[model samples]
Target: MGYFKDILKYEKKYRRFTVLNIVFNILYAFFNVLSVLAFIPVLNILFGAEKRVIDKPEYNNISDLGNYLEGSFNYFISQKIISEGEIKALSLICIISLSLFFFKNFFRYLASYVITFLRTGIVKDLRDNLYHKIVELPISYFSEKRKGDIIARMTSDVQEVEVSILTSIETLVREPLTVIISIGIMLFMSVKLTLFVFILLPVSGFIISSISKKLKAKSIKAQKETGTFLSFIEETLTGLRIIKGFNAENVIEKKFNNSTLSFKQLMTSVFHRQTLASPMSEFLGSATIITILWFGGTEVLNNTSTLEAGKFMGYIVLFYTVLNPIKLITTTFYNIQKGEASAERIMSVLNTKNEIKDLPNANAKEGFNDKIEFKNISFKYKKEYVLKDFSLTINKGETVALVGQSGSGKSTLANLITRFYDVNKGEVLIDGQNIKSITKKSLRGLMGIVSQDSILFNDTVENNIKLGSQNASHDAIKEASEIANAAEFIEDLPEKYLTNIGDSGNTLSGGQKQRLSIARAVLKNPPIMILDEATSALDTESEQLVQVALEKMMQNRTSLVIAHRLSTIQKANLIVVMKKGEIVEQGKHEELLAKKGEYFKLVTMQSLS
Candidate 1:
């Protein structure tokens, strides 16, 4: 129920629709009771036990109002039969019953119709908020989370919340109202029989509650298994080449089968308990009906109760009507219990506080001016520091290349400069101001990054090049592509700039993808460029071409080049060689070679290998 309260926050946006549903459900419940009660007159006409009265009854108190109305209705029907005969009386009862039935279904349909807005609206808002959070959270947040689990939370888990929670909105409101109205009428018909029903209902409710007590826990387990298999599928698809090369299909299939087996077992328990709700409730309701018939019939025979035979029969029919609502309410309760697990999973993500957020008064840095400085910054992704007491300075419009073995803190500097992750100690400053004080959007806006992977979506060549500068003109995209040496091949494509690259630009070669990524950065035309191993994954011919494009893009731009290949950084203004998260040597390529230090060893090693 607490989770239900949290979910209602999304409902505030669609309050008008919610109110309409409530109003219609109320009408439906009211008419549901009236339709059953309307059958009493027809029962009397058929039984041939109609009572006639010459005078109209007087209303004295509210307590006897039920009996007074019952007698008055019987008297009017008796006179109708005496004056106009059974034909007119029968037609009149038929008309009243038909009207009640029509409105009962009409209001029921209206309730369902109004609830559609809430059901779909809440799911949409939930998905929107989840996606916003996924994008806004820092990259470190995803380092420990499985991508498939997040996808499951966003897709199937949300759908479960809809099926098990939001879809039951009508039953949650209407069924209880139906039960209350039916109970009230039962009490009016015979207090003793109604009292007997009250005695048995709590016991029945306790049994249903007990069965569903473990449903939420089981449901959570099933959903987690769903995520596990989905993650396996995502991983398998992404690495299909590796899997097939290794001949690991059977291993992967067996692991997936185990996960599905666990999910199937858990869901079996959850659904079995859920399925028991209806039959158990119906059985209890039938038992209550049989008891009421025996007691009410005994009272009528011994003359201890004032209920007429026709009214008692109608009372029994009305009580039977109450059973379906009770069963539906019980079923809805079980569904909510299961849905609470999904709601908790969703709210966990929504309620998480992002550790990285812009300050209320943070300054927006539109452009770089002076030097970019790392002032004794110590940082770590975990327990051990990746960069400890590291300090460097690069002036405006300078190219500084960082060369190191993997895990030597070269890439960490690029991340720090871009504010992807903040320093645990000291500061990363742009133009003598701490980068933390700058709004992240504005800070990253001044720089263009080309990573090793050359990530590209499935879109046109023009659209991929103009990703950052979406409003750039056709001539600008063409110029950027030419600058990256991609225009020659792109122009040879089927549609050139209008060509649709397949998934992740798989239709293009590695060199083409990397060039497209470079073209994107060139189109943005930012002052600062961070090329993190931009050409480390290419062949000799592709590397040479990409190197030419990289040099052209780096003209007069403040660039931080992280590279493994020593040939690429030979002409950099300053080359820093790093070992074990600390700088080992810093000088020109010729100067470092003359010293025969760490940079010299790297060059010699690459030359040997």
Candidate 2:
């Protein structure tokens, strides 16, 4: 219920629509009761049970208002019968009943019409907000979550909220009004009979509530299973090549089948409980109506009840109208219970605290000055530290290279400097100020990164290059591509710069993809660059071409290059050798090779002179 209430808070933006819906629903309910009550006159005319009234009844005190209206209507019908005959009077009554029915349905449609705007509007805003939250969340958040699970929340869970919760809103608003108005008229007709109805309703309501008590818990399990299977599907698609290559298709298929089996079982239970709402409520409503019929019918037969046969039949029809709404209300309750689970999942992501965000007084860093310094920094992904009390300094325009074996915390330095993950202990200072004191957008704007993977979208070559500098002119893009040694290949493509690269730019060779990444960085034209093993995955010939592009991009920039191959960093101004989160050697490449230490050992292992 709390989650449902939170979701309703989004409706404030569509408050006008909500007000319109309520207004029309009120009209619909009023006319709905009137239409049912209209049949009373027709029944009286058919059975000749209404007495002749020559004079119209006078309006008096509010207490006698009900009798006055009923008397006045009967007198008019009697006049019609005398002047026009019983056939014409009955025709007039039918026409009046038909008009009442028309107005009832008209207002009901209007209520549904206006609510459509509110429902679609809320769903759009919810998706937009969720997407913004996902984008703004720190990179480390995704490291602990599955891409497929997040996709499930964004897609299926949102759909569930729309289906179960938003759809039930109309029922919640309209049905209750219908039930109230019908019951009020019933109480007016016979309080003793209505009182008995009230008792029977609460007992039925208690039974229905108890049946749906565990529905929310089961719904949560079912929705979570949906995420689990969706994650399995995403994983399978992503790693399909590996699965087939390893001949582990059977293993993967078995795992996927198990996940789907669990999901099917959970959904089966959920549907069984959800589908039971309608029939169970209908049965209870019918049982209550039967009891009322016996009690009211017995009294009417003995002439003790004020309700004549015709009027009692009308009462039963009016009570039957109330029954349908009560049944829908119970179904709505079940739907909301089911929808609350998805709402909770959505709110979980929306309500997550983004730990990395700009502070109130954070300054915008416009340009780089003196040096970038890591002062006694410590960081870790989980328990063990990756960088321990590590300190380094790179002056402006210095192209420093970090060389180390795997798990030696080379890339962690790039992550920390870029503020993708904050240090556990110490500060990363740009010039003399702490990086944390700078706004993230401005901090990131000063640097361009080229990682091992060339992450390109399924767009044109020019558009991929324009990612960092979206508004760059065509000439500027061309110049950047030329600087990265990618212009020759770009011109050879079918559509030149307008050529659509397939997913992840798989249409291009590894060298071409890496150069495009460099071209993107070149377009940003930042003063600082971080190259994280950019050519490690390329072939020998591709490495030479990408290396040429890297050297071109690093010129006059303060660069921190994390390298796996010792050959790439041989020409770097200073080389730092790391081992187990500590710097073991730092010198010019030739100087370190002369020392016959860690750096020399790395170069020797690489079979370099």
Candidate 3:
């Protein structure tokens, strides 16, 4: 119920649709009861049980209103029987019942129709909000979570919320009103009987509720297992070549089967408990009806109660009407319990605190000048420090290369400069301003990054190049491509710039993909460029091609080049050699060779001296 209330907060925008749905449901409930009550006069007329009333009943106060209306209806029927035939009177009663039923169904449809807007609108907003949150959360958050699990919350969990929570909304609104109206009339017919009904109903409700008590816990488990299998599928698709090459298909298959089996068992329990609501409520309702027949029938037969035969039959029919809604309400309750699990999962993501965000008074930084400085910054991903007391500075138009072993924290510098992860201690300053005090968009706007992996979407080559600079004209894109040495291959492609690159740009060769990445950076034309192992994965031929483009793009740019290949950084203005988390040496390439220190050892290890 707490989760349900949270979900309803998204309904604020669709209040008009919600209001219209409620109004129509109210009318539907009213006419639904009236339709059953209309059968009373028909039963009396058919059975020759109607009492004659020669005098018309008078208008009266609220307390006498019930009897006054009954007497007035009796007088009108008597005149109809006298003026017309009994058959015509029966026809009139049937016509009234048919019309009541018509309006009941019509308004029921209207309620469903209007609620569609609210239901679908909320689902859309929930997905949109979840996606936006996912995009805004820090990269560290994803490093701690499974991509497939997050995807499950976005797709399946949200869909579960729609199925389990939202679909029950109409029943929640309509059925309760039906139950209330029908019960009110039943109480009017016989207080003693209605009170007895109240006792029996709660007992049945208690039993039904006890059965569904564990449904939510099971549903949560089931939804979680869904995420597990989805994660497996995503991993399998991503690593299918490895799986096949290793001949581990059977292992992967058995693991997936186990996940599905567990999901099956949990869902089996959830659905069995859910399906029990219908038959249990129906059986309980039948038991209550039989008991009422015994008690009410005995009183009517022995002349011990106010209920006559026809009105007593109508009372039985009215109680039956209440039973259906009570069953639906119980089912709705079960569904809400099931949906609460999914709602909790969704709310968990939407409610996640983004640790990285712009400060309220943060200023937008438009350009970089002088130097980019890391002032004694200490940072860590988890427990141990990745960068401890790390300090460095890169002046404008200088290409400073960070050369290190794999765990030497070369890439962490790029992350820090871009504000991807704020330092645990000290500050990163652009020019002289603390990077934290700059709006993140503006801070990132001043630098362009080309990482080890070519992160391109499945889109046109032109669109991929124009990603950050979306408003770049065709000539600008071509010029940037030509500058990065990508125009050669791009022009050779089937559709040239308009060509669609496959997923992650898998269709492009390694060198071509890296050049496109460089072209994308060139198009953004940022003052500071961070190229983190941008050509580390290429073949020697491809490396040379990409290296040429890298030099071309780094010309006149304040560049931070994180590299593993010592040969590539030989021409860099400054080379900083790092081991563990600290810088061991910094010098011009020739000066470092003369030092014969850690930088010299790295060059010797790479056989580049």
Better of 1 and 3 by TM-score: 3
Q: Model 3: per-residue lDDT, tens digit, 1-609?
A: 999999999989999999999999999999999888866765675567776677899987998887887777778887888789788988998788889999999999999999999999999999999999999999999998888889999999999999989999999999999999998888888998899899889999999999999999999999899999999999999899999999999999999999999999999999999999999999999999999989999999999988887788889999999999998999989999999999999999899998889999999988887998999999999999999999998899999999988888999999988988989999999988999999999999998889899899999999999999989999999999998999999999999999999988989998899999999999999999999999889999999989999999988899999998888999898999898899999999999999999988888988953
Candidate 2 lDDT, tens digit per residue, 1-609? 999998999999999999999999999999999987877875675557776778889998998888898888888888888899888888998899899999999999999999999999999998999999999999999998888778888998889999999999999999999998888888889999899899899999999999998889988988888888888888888788999999999998898799889888878888898999999999999999899999999999999998888888888999899989999999989999999999999999999999888889999999998899999999999999999999999999998999988999999999999989989999999998999999999999999999999999999999999998989999999999999999999999999999999988989999999999999999999999999999999999999999999999999999999999888998888898988888999999889989999988888888953
Clashing pairs in 3: none
Q: What is the lDDT of residue 287 in candidate 3?
A: 96
Clashes of 2: 0
Error of 2 at 97 (Å): 1.7
- CA lDDT, every prediction? 0.89, 0.92, 0.92
Candidate 1's displacement at residue 127, Å, is: 0.7
